[model samples]
Every structure is written in structure tokens, then in C-alpha cells.
Target: MRNIPTRHTAGRTIGGAVAALSLITLTACGGDSGSESTGAAEKLGENEGEVSILAWPGYVEDGSTDPEVDWVSGFEKETGCQVTSKVYGTSDEAFNLAKSGEYDVVAASGDLTLRMIAAGQAAEVNTDLIPNYEGIYDFLKDREWNTVDEKNYGIPHGYGANLLMYNTKDVTPAPTSWKAVFEDAPKHKGQVTAYDSPIYIADAAVYLMAHQPDLGIENPYSLDEKQLAAAVDLLKAQRTSVGEYWSDYTKTQASFETGDTVVGTTWQVIANLIDPKKAPVEAILPSEGATGWNDTWMISSKSKSPNCAYAWLNHISDPEVNAQATEYFGEAPNSDKACEFASEGHCETFHAGDEEYAKKIWFWNTPINDCLDGRTDVECTDYQDWTKAWAEIKG
Candidate 1:
């Protein structure tokens, strides 16, 4: 979700954890070790005096937005390393920026983390260097997007789901499935909305997996040409009723307020921001489930201040620190300990630690020709295919 201003970029260089275990798919393509190496540090050393970071706007706040929203100051004070940071609006933007090797670390969404690893822009993180690592959620550890070839590349930060949000007054009978926005979308006619990104195609694939089981779509991110075409067809139909596609959180909330959009997909953060007294809207995870995000904090392979970078990683993963970060960013924290640090009801509201709820979410991962689900019988379409298909659906 675009919770902050468009092009909201900033920087902090600091010195940074070990934390816990989780079971999940490993989605990154670990190119051979022979792939270009930016010099992954063999061991941690003295604070390098400074560290640089690239992240989503709200992910790296130093109290600039609100004085109380500062996580960076404490890290700098404890490590004696100054912090500098740059924030990006989208995963694609973050991926490109990381490639420049200008930052020591990055908070990458699942969609970009694996791609960065495959491109060798990020390196395998030495988990032993992070003492706070033991605090992370077991389900998030060694996941496909954050680990490659059984090697951990980064730490699982926080996560949230894309929910089906609707104006309670207008969307009758309370929608329970994705069909409300797909097959039955016309009933809302010109009032439906959706996320404006190529990754959204996975949402359509998700719907097909349930409504048309014959498609044999096990993983929404792993789609062959035939399956992809089917998903694109469904989205193309949805395009007709889409009043507007959105990435900006404020714009989406505004649309709901004005009743320009009655039903569509949304982030939990957006749902929280909308004044229910005025908009009377509610968000739900439809029966077909939803596409979500599991962001990771990865160190750059070419980091000039590797020690400081590791320092920052460890600092952020601390239970108190992780709580502050996830709360500000509007997602469930990675550590069970973070739950104690959160405000009353915050953890329950986001379904924190609910393994069953997590199982329902198809976290975002970049599509690749080699099926991510381990199906060797067919070559699935890659991210480039999704991009092209998105354009056609939009047109």
C-alpha cells in the first residue's frame, strides 16, 4: 500500500540481529555462486561509522513524520553509527535502486527480494551475527523469498494481506468470496476497484484456483501460458467495472469516502485509516484468499559498511524495535515478542501469530519461467509475461 507520499525518499546510514524460525516456501533463484559477487562480508567487524538504507517510505522513519515515530535514533545511539536512508514507492523502484549499490541495506517486499538475490545485488546474510534473530516468527524463517539454496539472505520483517474491502451500506449480504469483485462485479458497475500493479494478476489467478479448479493452479505466482491467459481474461472482464485502479492509500480511502468505489481489494493499513463513522466500510479476506506481502530486510552485496549494516539488522529485529517498526508500517510484526510491545488489540486485529490465517494468504513473489511450486512438467510465465499481460488487461 502507498501509505506515504508518492516518491517519498529519505536516507539514514547506521550500523545494525539473530532471530527465529518459520516454515515457508523458498522462492528465490540462487544463481550459481559463480554469479557476480559484490563482496559479501566474511565476518562482522567494528562499527563502520555509517550505514545507508533503501526502504519503503514508512519503513525507515527517524521521527520526521511524527516525533514519536523514531526507530533510527536509538540504533544510532547504541551503535555509534550515523544512519542515512532512501525510501521508494514500489518494489520495482526499490529493486532498481538496490542495483545501483548506493545503499548498504534494503527493506524489500517479497516480490523484489528474490529478484535482487538472483541478480546478485543482495548477499546471504550471516544469521549468526544477529542476536535478535531468535525472536523472529518460526513460520517466516528461511522462506523462499528470503532464502536461496538453503541459505538465509535476510531477516523476515513484517507482513499483511490484501483484503476485500467494501462499503458496508452499499455492498449487500456481506461478500465472502472474490467473486464479488470478479464474476459478480457488474452488479457494482463502475464502483469496483483494485490494486494498480502487475502483481495483481496473481489475485485473478487466486480466484481461478478456487472457482475453476480444473486450471490446476497450485501457486498463483507459478502460472503457465494457458493458466495466465485465463487469469488475464478474468481481469480483462474486471477492468470494465473498475472505477479506478489505486496504489496510493489516501486516494483509495478518498474514493471509498466519496462512494466512488463500493467494493475492491485493500491493505489492512488502508482499512484502518478510513474513518468508518464516515465511510462505513469493512475489509475481509474472501474465501478464495488473497495476495499479500512478507517483506525482508536484506544487506547489499556491495555494502561499504558491512559491520554497521549487520548492526542495523540486529537492532531492527529486537522485539521492541520490531514492534515499533511493524506498528508504524501497519503490519503484523515478525516476532511473537513483538506482540507484547504492540498496543492492546493490535496483534489480534492483524491476526498476529495465527498460523491458520497465514496459510490463507498467497504472499507475493516474482513469477519465473521455472515454476516456483516445483512443477517441472511445464514452464511457467515469468514476471515479464505478467507485465505484458497487465498492460493488455489495462488497455
Candidate 2:
């Protein structure tokens, strides 16, 4: 649902050229990169030129040789466009570098998509160039942040839950709520780890949405003054249980494997990483529906090889590519077709393709006034308040 922190925590996303995974298409213009019409079709031809991509670790890396994952070659072969990527450690990193217009495209998160579009850091995508976008779920179609006035900027990628994972062999009566790592976490002590970001404030906010209805909280990110205070106070109260705030996926896996932690927030991929036989780990949705995020692929307004980028976008959406991404990346494919080719035990074992199951689960969308519950009157507290509250909660 969020990012797996890497070197990008250093503040910039543009790094060395390493081959990695590819991404998707677009919609509206929130801000102007040029005076071009958002509706105009920009042909991304395979000029056999080069394009740069700013993305996450596993998206393009194949783990074949040096950097571990090697997906860049396939994209190059298929499109004849050379790809060079800077694998980001955090969304903030990509957002910053992308703002410079130095790179072509980015794998943006829901939280930053709007910020990027507003800043004119990314280009509004022409859906006509990327036909596969039509397959994206309507839920992601056009929204306030990624799209402005019905125009799109990002191609819907994939997503999974930020679950409470545990060492199944050791933990019994499996913990079901965020409380296992927050409220009742004292017993776990050194074994507990939490997400190392202000964004995690949303976890507490979501919990409040489910348990503290009297608080009158709606969107976890859209906290009013009183609502923000409550979320911060709840986290500050639960701070003692937070032993570590994890930012790296490899380290997170190590924490569980070493039995250093019994329960904490983690992505679904972490569950698959735990040895099913040795140390069993499970992704608990919790009794209350959980908060999560979807990874989206958005085109760069300045991409020289925009055509090749669009090709990669559609390629990843294909059922086979989507299935491959799931097996290797450890997240569910957003495309319905991709879920059809879910890896072994993925569909039956995890309901990987169950539309009914997905509906029952709340996918994280960027918080906006067309509130998740659909009340248009409430105003979400600005981001500054969220920041101040995050510091107080984690302090």
C-alpha cells in the first residue's frame, strides 16, 4: 500500500542506470507542463532511442546478476527502447526527483500522485497512446489527485494490504487488530516493529475509524483539528509498543525470520517470503477492514521514448505479465486478467482473483472530499497538520 524505503530515503530518486520493471498510462492535466491539450494524442513511437524510468526495487530488477532483479532487458527487446532506471527507496524520493523533470516517468503512490500533478512534476497521460488503460478498474479511473477535471496522469499498477503479520509457529490465537502491535504491544516488547514513516499515522486513523466512531473521523488522512489530535494522542499512547519502525523489505523479512518480531504491519509479499514450512507468517486483514494502497504507473511528460513506455505499460497489464509480477514482486495484480493467471496456490490459497473478496476489502485511495463514504461537506485538515501530528506521535 505504501513504499519500501531504500536509498531514496537519502532524498533523490534519480540514481544509476539499472535494469528494472516497467509501468502504465494516463488521463488529465492538473497543471501545465506546456500548453498542449490534455486530450491531444501524443504518439510515443519506437524511435529506438532511450528513456529513463524512476521506479521501485522489484518493479524492473530481475535479481539476475548485480542489482538482483533484471526486467529492463525484456522491455528493451520488445520495444527497442533502451531503459535506464533509478530504483527508489521511497515515494518521496521519486516525487522530488520527478519534480526536476530530469527523468521520464515514475511509479507514484496515491499520497504523492496529486502532489506531483499539482507541481507539474509529471505529464498528463494520453490514454489513447496506452490502450491497456481501459482495463483498469473503474475505481481508479478518474480522481481528484491523479486526474484533474477527468484527465489522467497515472496508469493503475497493483497493490496489497499493510497487514499485521506474525510468526505463525510461535504466535497463537493470532492477533487480529492493529492493537496487537499498538495497544497490547508491551508483552511483545523488543519483538515489535512498526512502519517508519509519518504515513503510518493513517494506521491509527483507520483504527479510529473502525473503533472510535464517536471521534467522528472519516478519512484517515483527512483529519480535522480535533480528529488530528486524537490520532496523534492514540499513537503517542501506543508508542511504547513500537520497538522499531521498519523501512526496508529485506530487513523486515529478516526481522520475522529471526523471530525478532512476532507481529507488526507489513505488505502481503512478506507473507509469501516467510517459509511456509519453517516460519509460517500470515497477512491478517484484521476484523476491521484494513487500509492499503495501490502502486500506479504514470507517464512522464518529457519522455523521449514515450511510445516505448506506453508499450511497457500495456505489456505489464497483460494477464501473463501481471501474473509474473505477482509471483516475483509479492503483490496482487490490479488487472482482472492478470489475476486469472495467478501463480500456483495464489488464486485458491489467497483468493488472488476473487472480485468479491476485493470489494469486501477497502483499497486505499488518496483522501479527498468525495469522501470514501461520500459526504461532500467535510474538509480534510491540511498536510501540515498531519506532519506536525506525525512528529508528536513518533516523538
Candidate 3:
């Protein structure tokens, strides 16, 4: 019942409704708030009996997907908050669904969280209500995507980086950089695979950041039109050698196992799933670093069960539960303590709580016109532009 990470889909337009949402200046710590006047709950009320949740698949389990993978039941049992959950495939889908105001809580990736905030769908969270928040890694807290104007919008969930994965048997002269999938891709023509998302463009930008310093690409998410064009050009060139553009976990695993794909961008989870006997593979955060995701759990502005929603957040952040959830999803736990409850060697495998290694990743952030890298001289292209460019790259 393992599932792939929920990612944005290419060519899916961010319609006028979403595009028209107010644009907020994204800052490293706390900057300004352009979002609607929605404040965090001052205190929790009695249990609301039931709380609805919208999240990525495998995030909220009740022993339904797999009898052993049940996290919701315990929350319901302990808090008296009956948990009703819905799963979303992509960030766009989650954004639209969250706008309905039906679900009390929604688990969103970095790309979707800001949009929810701008649209007045997400409420600023009073992290004080959730004691477990203190145990979370400081690096994962109060980021631009999940926090605005010094307000907390949600709790950090799990995070993992997009890595350079290559078959040891087919890819010789071990790849220490992403050049294997960008510049040197043609060498393994028709055998290289890349992530099937516009966000994948950031992977190329990461490479340029290290190898093509002349481009001045400060942040992968904040790309000007020219910078985006450069990334598009690199991806377009890599496209010729790409055997398949993959988002589905099974397909990519199969390709690597059968030798159809020898090199590409992959999640550590996908690399772990591959059978070493059939396809010896290694996944690494290349020297150039990588694009990754740090999902957040935010409450809805119109939530009917605010107390229950807050309770759920606290329950999930417990070291034991956090360990179960993150390990099951194959990402780094948010805290060092959670590592203790996780399977032996799990933290080492994912590098949980390693701040130095964490710094190496440019966690996915929504691209906006106001450059996230603090460049005011030029406007950066937004996700909409990236979507259109992705279509062009694929074609």
C-alpha cells in the first residue's frame, strides 16, 4: 500500500481564481502578510465529535490501506474526534478541494500551502496549543511557505529530497553530480528518466546554480524569465535522452529494475523499493543539492471542528506517531526524538535531523512574481509560467 509522494502535475494551469489570489512577499523568517484577516484560534473548545481531513494518500491511515498502518484510529480513540479523511493526488487538487471549506484540516505541500493562505483558506495556527511543536526541528519551522507575517499557518510534516539515482551496473564512473541527467544524459540516451512535474525544472536550475554560476540563479523556485528559459533549455536537451517522464512509483521502480531506466531524479523511497539483485542502484543528494518537499498540516479557515483539528495536530506530532508517519512515507522525521521511535537505521538512512544535510536541499516553494530570493530589480516567473514551459519542454 506504499504510495508515491504527492507532487504538482505539469501542464495543469493555475486558473484565474488561483492566479487572482493576493500575492504575499515571501521571506525567510517573517515579512508581511497580504492574506485575508484570518487569525489563529485563541483557545480550543470541546471536541467537535468529528473532524474531516484532506491529505496526500498514506498520510492519514485507519488500518484501511493496510491493517498495520493505522494512525487515525488512535487519535480518534484518544481525542474522541472521529477522523474522516480524503486523499489528493496533486497539489492543485488539494488547493481546489481545500477551498470548499468542508474539511477541517488539510495536509499541503510547499507549493500549495501559500496559495491556500493567500486565498483565505488557511488559518494561522497557534502553535502554543500544540505542545509537541516544541520538539520539531527549528529548521523546519516558521519558513516562508508555512509562515507569513510571523504567523504560523501549519505544522511541518515529513520532508525528502529529489536525488540523483543511477543503476550501478549501467552507469559507470559514478555520478557525483546531476550532470548525469542533464548535460551527460545523451550518453545514456533513451535510458535516463526525470520526474514528471514542472517542479522538475528546479532540478536543472540546481545544477546550474553550482555549474553555471554566471546565471545567478539564487533560488531554484525564484526564476526570472531568462533563468527559466535556461532551465527549460537544459530540460529540453535532456528530454531527448529521457526514456520516460515518471510520477508513478511502480512504473519508475519497474523501469529501474528492468534496466529500462539507468539514471534520473528519484526519491529515496523509490530507490529503496528497487530490488538490488535486479538493479543495483544508489540515490544521492548530488554535490549541486536538489529540489525537495516539506509538507505542512494546516487547519481550514472555515473549519467546523477547530478543537478536534488542533488535537489531531498535537497527536500526530508525538514522537511515536511522528516516527510511524514519516518512516512509513520514507522521509526524514521532523525531530531528533522521533528518530528514536523510528525503525533502527531509519534516521541514518534518511539523515533525519541532520541540519547540515538539510541545508543542502532547496525545499519546494511556490514560485511567485515577487522573487523569493529577495531580488527586487526583476520579476520572477510564477508557477503558471513554469507550467506553460513544461508543456513546451515535453513537446
Go through the candidates in order and give each one's C-alpha lDDT: 0.80, 0.62, 0.82
TM-score of 2: 0.82
Alpha-carbon TM-score of each model against the true structure:
0.89, 0.82, 0.89
Off by over 4 Å in 1: 1-40
* Per-model tally of clashing residue pairs: 33, 18, 0
Off by over 4 Å in 3: 1-37
Model 3 TM-score on a 0 to 1 scale: 0.89
What lDDT does model 3 reach?
Answer: 0.82
lDDT of 1 by residue, 1-395 (tens): 41111101110000000001111111233233224454445677799899999988788889988999999998999999899999887787787788777899999887787677767788788888899998788878877677665678899899989999999899998999999999889999999999988899999998998889999987788799999999999999999999999877779989998889999999888888888877898899888778899889999887888888999999989989889888877899988899999988888988888877887787787777767655668878877788889999999
Please provide, for model 3 over 204-278, each residue's C-alpha lDDT reduced to its tens digit, 9 standing for 90 to 100. Answer: 888888888899987788799999999999999999999999877678999999999999988888888899999
Worst 10 residues of 3 by lDDT: 2-11
Query: Which segments of candidate 2 are over 4 A away from where they belong?
Result: 2-40, 46-48, 62-70, 143-145, 276-278, 348-350, 360-362, 365-379
Cα error, residue 89 of model 3, in Å, equals 2.9
